[model samples]
Target: MKRARGRGPLSTVVGIVLLALMLFPVYWMVNASLQPAGSTLRGGWFPLHPDFGGYAVALREQGRNLLTSLLVSLGSVVLGLGLAAPAAHALARFPLRGTRAVLLAVLVTQMVPGIVVADALYDAYAGLGLLDSYLGLVLADSTAGVPFAIIILHAFMRTIPGEIIEAARMDGAGRLRVFRSVVLPLSTNALVTAAVFTFLFSWSDFLFALTLTSTPSVRPITLGIYEYLGAHTDQWNAVMATSVLASLPAALLLVLSQRFVTAGATSGALR
Candidate 1:
């Protein structure tokens, strides 16, 4: 027990060193954004006289695109959960034939390259008139979100005991009611987990956003940053400022959603 009490000091120091190495780039990105002007990272390690000019330009130019990304990500989350929850519940509870095959297919879809999916979607979307529209992006993003959510939701829901589900049924609750009142309420963590991951996937998506949208009218923030690479390379501060703005939402979501994945604990002990 004493041996398992904590890691040794050397191990802790090693871990901290690795963590700092990983975070150095993020620190540099923030540091670069504050500089008034820099063709390269000659702004030193600290910004004594921080300039807000880059942030000003980012907000004025990319604010609308940022809002567009937020809208599409949220839409993908709702649409993904709406489909995945019921399907995952059914897959978890029912002993339907070919369940393993279906799960395998879902996993296989993840292995398929995003570029291929984007190309196929482009052709279908062009005929269906979904190009360069909010609905189009939402639907495209959900192709990733829905499958991933199903995998996450299914893994969690499977842990729910059959006895609890039976108790709900014995009390005269319909299948839908039991799902709504009991299973869903107890699986709150899984639902939130799935939603958060789905949101992040849709948020950071560049391929589908790049392929599906042509006009600037429905551009996401990722595309906005791509524009900075060409048009504003000389303005590196603005470019970094745009990157910082883009990373803020995903970072905040990850920080705010505290994941407590209890291993094989009973539902009563969850809270």
Candidate 2:
């Protein structure tokens, strides 16, 4: 009993310390954003006084519309999830001769860096007149997310007993019907987890959004924040302010899906 009590306090202290370390940067970002411009230069990390003017500036700035970023992020999340779900379902349920090869290809894609293909993708988009468009960004972001989605959902589907699928087929249900009625319902955890990851990746993509897009009307928040920086100077307060604002949707998304994420992670590869 004495040893258990001692370990409890030690574990609690370690947990609190880790939490503080993880949250300090977020606290500082919010603190700096609330400070008056140029205050960070003199005051360093902590703000002398907190204000909302920085947020107002970030919101209403002519060439850095944060609203556009929010809309694009939301749209990307929806589109990517929509595309990923069907592909994941097909890959999980169907067994072609090259199915393993195709799955391996998807896994291999995660290894390729997005930056490496940016220039080539930019040139292709430019040729197709897709530069400075939300569709272009969404398509690029979707490709990045699809591979991981397939891998995740595939494992979850594999965990499901083959007997269930065989039973469904014996009942005269077609493959699509079986997927809709059985597999999809069972894999909601994986689907929700994939959506969370897709949203984060799409919202946080900076390189493709920066190089492929130039106009503020279509710029995502990641690139919108860059407008505050210059060739030789930077605005730390607005950058921090915009950064905080930009992070809200992603936070809200994860919070809403926390249950599914928890279930998905704890369940492991489906089974």
Candidate 3:
């Protein structure tokens, strides 16, 4: 048998260097968070004497914002999936008219600049008394999640064998039953993919949060961090500490669900 080949030394070195460059900022953020001064400008390369005071201050100051973010993100996931999954299923399985146009419109919406959506939603939301509210934020964030989830779920649903669906229908299952029992179970990977990304999108949303809210009520962590950047310019460690905390959920989720994400994303591709 032939021996297993390894990457060339030069390529390995290049990859290592590139990785270091990409990850340097993250390491620096953690480093700054550990510094007693929380000052990046004067921070040492290593935390010879680490300080977690920054985290204490972050928890004390921004805890409510973090919780608000979680609630809004979760709400977005629920609303987004509720809307996306069915639309995707109909588009993929049904021979509805203008299906292609609707899909195209979805793609176009993604291309529309976020600032434009925020601007338009501001007046409409204000008129509806949704300003500075969790519902408003969830609705706005769902714009991003719903479209993305539709595209992902559509692609994955298209890969479901036609015979399986027909068999389910023949067994006295109506359309809704077929969808709930047949389609959803087979689409687990895609559902997880959509849910994970939806959560991430809503979790990281800033444009809607910034535009729609003028009050201290329902502040997500992104807005909290932005205001903190200005309000606590001297306390870089606390800011960085909050950054680390915010990064944790998304990072952990992505790492844990990487396999499902990759599988779902690539499921419909033909060989």
Winner by lDDT: 3
What TM-score would you give candidate 1 relative to the actual structure? Answer: 0.92
Pick the winner on TM-score between candidates 1 and 3: 3
- Cα lDDT over the full model 1: 0.87
Candidate 1's displacement at residue 242, Å, is 1.1
Please write out the lDDT profile of model 3 over residues 1-271, one tens digit for every residue: 1232344666788999999999999998899999986458888999999999999999999899999999999999999999999999999999899999999999999999999999999989979999989999999999999999999999999989999999998999999999999999999989999999999999999999999997777899999999999999999999999999989889999999999998888887741
In order, candidate lDDTs are 0.87, 0.78, 0.93
Which has the higher lDDT value, candidate number 1 or candidate number 3?
3
Query: What order do you get sorting by TM-score, best first?
Result: 3, 1, 2
Tell me the tens digit of each residue's lDDT in model 2 across 172-268: 9998898889988988998888878887888888888887898766887777666666521345666677788888888988899999988876665
Sort order, lDDT high to low: 3, 1, 2
For TM-score, candidate 2 versus 3, the one ahead is 3
Alpha carbon lDDT of residue 197, candidate 2? 85
Task: Look at candidate 1 and tell me the lDDT of residue 260.
Answer: 32
| Best candidate (score: TM-score) | 3
What RMSD, rounded to one decimal, does every model reach?
Answer: 3.1, 2.8, 2.2
Which of 1 and 2 is ahead in lDDT?
1
